[model samples]
Target: MKSLPPLGDDAVVRLSRQGGVAAIHTLTRPREIAFAQCNIDQRTRICSVLEGCLAIEDPASGRGDQRFYEIEVCYRIGEQDDRMVMKVPEDRAPGELVHLWDKGEVL
Candidate 1:
């Protein structure tokens, strides 16, 4: 696993509220539309994890012009790189989950 440093609540919240939206726009160049906050987690009181959804032009082959996608941001305060993002397929069994890559593995 890699180092996953936990960030402070203020820093994480700032990124969630301000930086995240700008980043998504820069990456997607989406049409001017209001973004929506789908979820927010601060129960730990250490840092914030935010999940938001936005409509963007679909770049997938044979897809329509617009589609909704969710983005999640998690910041932990520590000195180990164990961060991971996973996409669980709804059609698959729960035990069928697999890691796409492990720390230090070549991409």
Candidate 2:
């Protein structure tokens, strides 16, 4: 699998909602990448991912307890299920951030 480009300090993370769905996108100088899309039921996970990315972009703007890192975002392709999953190991996750395999379905 090809790795995604690292998110720079200037990366812009935005979250928008339409009805019961929420979408997260990251915009850099060259391109805008769709990070994740989830239903209202999965709001927590999507919110956490957005918070993490924003924290990484500007640490001082984030909560002091949150620790952001470069996480591997993956999609389950060609499968019956389609979802975007952010892989953050349990040990590395802070108390507020979701762990990699905790919910299984990110989107």
Candidate 3:
């Protein structure tokens, strides 16, 4: 496993690279991104597709004291990341899941 650089999400809603390595991204804002990874050789690295992202002040996932929304997401593994991104929809608010659906990643 080659040590990959720290990938970051720009103002855009998507972050895309080439590799299947494991990486951690800071979701401080809302955005649209497709996570993927491709190995040039036997090595792998964390890959991502950052685009159409809109960082919301409110945390979508459970993180703050007042829980506004809580979602469960499951991703399907593909060549790089998962072929499909899946998640259990929660009726916590209006147009919640719809928002996710609006993005490329459906829940």
Candidate 4:
């Protein structure tokens, strides 16, 4: 199971290549989105938000191996899916970086 460190509540995730809207087997973890309140359905395959904004970016725009993709989620209250193909980065993801934020402390 390949997993990148958990991202903070305000941190931004950039993608390396364009992703397939087909949806990954497992979507981004809702727990990773918010600090400690109102998480989304894990099986929803949707992006949720407790604070900040969400965006799917292409980190590999100027990098190499433009095939990798990232969820690159921000934050939202309503239901929103990236009908537009998402983009993740290529470079090796960080190690055990989960829990990026200190929960509640604005990243």
TM-score of each candidate? 0.22, 0.25, 0.20, 0.24
Candidate 1 per-residue C-alpha lDDT over 1-107 given as tens digits, one digit per residue, 9 for 90 to 100:
22224434322221111122234554432221111221223223212122111112122412232222222234453643233322222122121111111111111
lDDT of each: 0.24, 0.34, 0.27, 0.31
lDDT: the better of candidates 2 and 4: 2
lDDT of 4 by residue, 19-96 (tens): 344434343322233323423342121233211112323434424423343445443334432222233332432221
What is residue 81's positional error in candidate 4, in angstroms? 15
Each prediction's RMSD over C-alphas, in Å, is 14.4, 15.9, 15.1, 11.8
lDDT of 2 by residue, 1-107 (tens): 32233332222223211111222222111212333343444555544554564433332322333323333333434433233323232334444333332323454
Rank candidates by lDDT, best first. 2, 4, 3, 1
Select the stronger candidate by TM-score from 1 and 4.
Answer: 4
Ten-residue region with minimum lDDT total, candidate 3: 42-51
Please report the TM-score between candidate 2 and the true structure. Answer: 0.25
Residue 69 in candidate 4 has what lDDT? 36
